[model samples]
Target: MPRRPSGINDLDLAIYGHIAEGGELTLSEISRLSGRSKGVIFRHLRKLSALGVIEVREVGGVLLASPSRSPRRVIAMGIMRAAEYPYVLGILRGLRDIYGPVRVLVYEDAWREAQDLLSGRIQLAMVPALTALVANRLGGGRVQIIGGGSGGGMGVVRGTGGSGHAVVRTSNTELCAERLGLDGPRSYFGGPGDILGALVSGKVHEGVLWEPYLSMASASGLRVEQCEIEHCCLLSANSGVADQYGKISRIAAAAISSARSADLQAYAKLVDLPVQLVESSVRGYSFHEAPDVAYLERMLDAARRALLPGSSVRDAVVA
Candidate 1:
C-alpha cells in the first residue's frame, strides 16, 4: 500500500505561525497540539519547507523551524501637514506588509532631522522636496533620491481685512514669495496645515497651503485666497546604503499606486484614520519615481544662485 499525500488544506498554518512567532517546535509537539498523526505533521512540515515559508533545523536529532529574515526598519517624516501624512502612512503600511515589522518616525520640522538622518545617523528619511534638494546638495552623494510625490502648486491665503492678523508661511516660503514678489509682514508656521488652520480661524491674514487643504478651506465658508507655488515630497536614503535605494523606491511607488486603487467608499476602512481625511489625502496628490539626475542638478544650480549669501549650506552632488 502507498502512503497518502497531504491535502492543500492540511498545510497546517498553525505550525508555520508558531515558527513565525520565534518558537521552534518538533513534529511530535505539533501533532499533539493539532491532534494530527506524527506522519501528517511531518508531511506538512516538509511541504512548508518546500514552499520556502520556513527553515528546518536539526538539533540533537530533533527538527526545528525558524523564520527566514528579520523585519525591516523604516522612518517617515513630514506628517505635521495633514495632506502629507496620508501618503507617508500609506508607504509605511505597504512596506510593513512587504518587509514586515516596519517602524516609523514622524517629525513636524523634517528639514533639519532629514539632513541628520541622511548623514547615516538614521536609516530612513521622508522629507519635503525642498529639504530633499538641500540634503542632496549638502550631503555630497551621501543622500540618494529614491522616490517623491507628484509635483503640485502651493497657495497663499489671506484674511480679507484685519489689524495685527498674522501671515503664516513655511520656512522655505521665502523662495516662493520671492518668485511671486510678495512683500508684507509674515510669520512662519511649522507646516502647511498649521498655516491653513490659522487662516481659517482668522488668526492669520494669509498663509501658504497645498491643494486639498486649499480646497477644504474654501469649502469651510472662510474667505480664502490662493496663489500657485511648487510643492513635492521625497523618499531618500543615505549614500552608503544606495544598494537599497531601488528596493525602497519600488516599495514607495507601489504604495502610492495601491492607495490610488483603493475604493473611495472603503477609505474609511483604513486603520486609525477617518474617511474624510483619507479622501482629502488621496485627492489631487500623485507619486513619482526617482527624479532624473539632470533635473536635480538644475534645481541644485538654481538653489545655489537663488538662496541668499551663506543661506545654502552646500552644493548637491552631480552625476
Candidate 2:
C-alpha cells in the first residue's frame, strides 16, 4: 500500500497546491484563489517557511517563493585533492539536506585566479583568509564573508638536530610565521602535494602544514615539531549580495551542525580515511548562527592582525 504524507494539514495542502503550478503568486492572488484573507494566507506562508517547505526570496522590496531552492556554489582550493576533498564532500553532503544542490569550483592556490573568479568573473569563491584580505584590499566588495572551517591546526616541522635547515611552510603559514616572530623563508610552496614532496625529498628540513600532511610527514620518519599557531577557514562572497551570502552561510552552518550531531561512530568513520590527518579537520569545524554586522567586523579585525608585519595568531568563525 502507498503511504500518506505526514504532518501536513489542510492549509498546508492548499498552499502547496496553489504553488504547485511552479509559478510565483502574490498573497492577493493566493487569497483570491482560496477565498481567504490576505493576512491568513501570509500567516500560512510563514508557517511553510518555518517548516523549510519553501524559500523566501526578496526582490526589490517584494518577497517571492520560487518552486526551486536557491542555487549555491563554493570556490575552494584543493577541492579535488585527496587530503581535503573528502571532508569537503562530507560537509557538502550535510549541506544538501538543508540547502538543496551545491557546486564547487576548484583552484590550486592561484590568488590571482581567485580574484578573477570573484570579480563577477565567476559565481563563487573559496580562498584562504589571507587571500580574501588581498581581495578586500583590491575592492573585492562583491565578495562577502559567509562561513568557513578550521582548515586544520598548523605547526612548523623542524629537523632532529634542532638547527634551522631549509624551512618550509604552507601557503597560509605566513600567519604562523608572524605568530612565532619568524620572517618566512625566501622560498615557499603552496599546495599540500608540493609541500609533502619537498619534505619527503629532504629538500626542506622544517615546514608548516595542516593535517593528513602533517601525519603523513610524521609517519614517513620525519621528526615533526609543533609550532604554536591556530589555523582558520573563511567563506566570502560579493559584498552587495547579502541575501545570497545569508543563504549560503545558513546552509554551511546547518551542515556543520548536522556533522556535529552525528554519532561518534560516524565521526570516527569520517576521520579514519586512508590519509593521516588531524581529527579537527573533520570534526572541529563549527559555524555562527546569528551572524551580522558585528561578526563581520570582528573577522576583519582578526584577519588584519594575522596579516600584520610579524604576527602569527589569527581568529576565525566556522560560518
- lDDT per residue as tens, model 1, 20-77: 5446677677777778797878887787666555667789988776654441232232
Q: Write down the lDDT of every candidate, Cα atoms only.
A: 0.54, 0.50
Per-residue error at 314 for model 1, in Å? 22
Model 1 clash number: 5
Q: Give residue 310's error in model 2 in angstroms.
A: 9.0
Model 1 alpha-carbon drift over 4 Å, by segment: 1-80, 84-90, 97-99, 112-116, 119-122, 162-174, 200-204, 223-231, 263-274, 292-319
Locate the minimum summed-lDDT window of 10 residues in model 1. 1-10
Q: Which of the numbered candidates is closest to the native, going by highest TM-score?
A: 1
Highest-scoring model, lDDT: 1
Report how far off residue 234 is in candidate 1 (Å).
Answer: 1.7
Model 1 scores a TM of 0.58
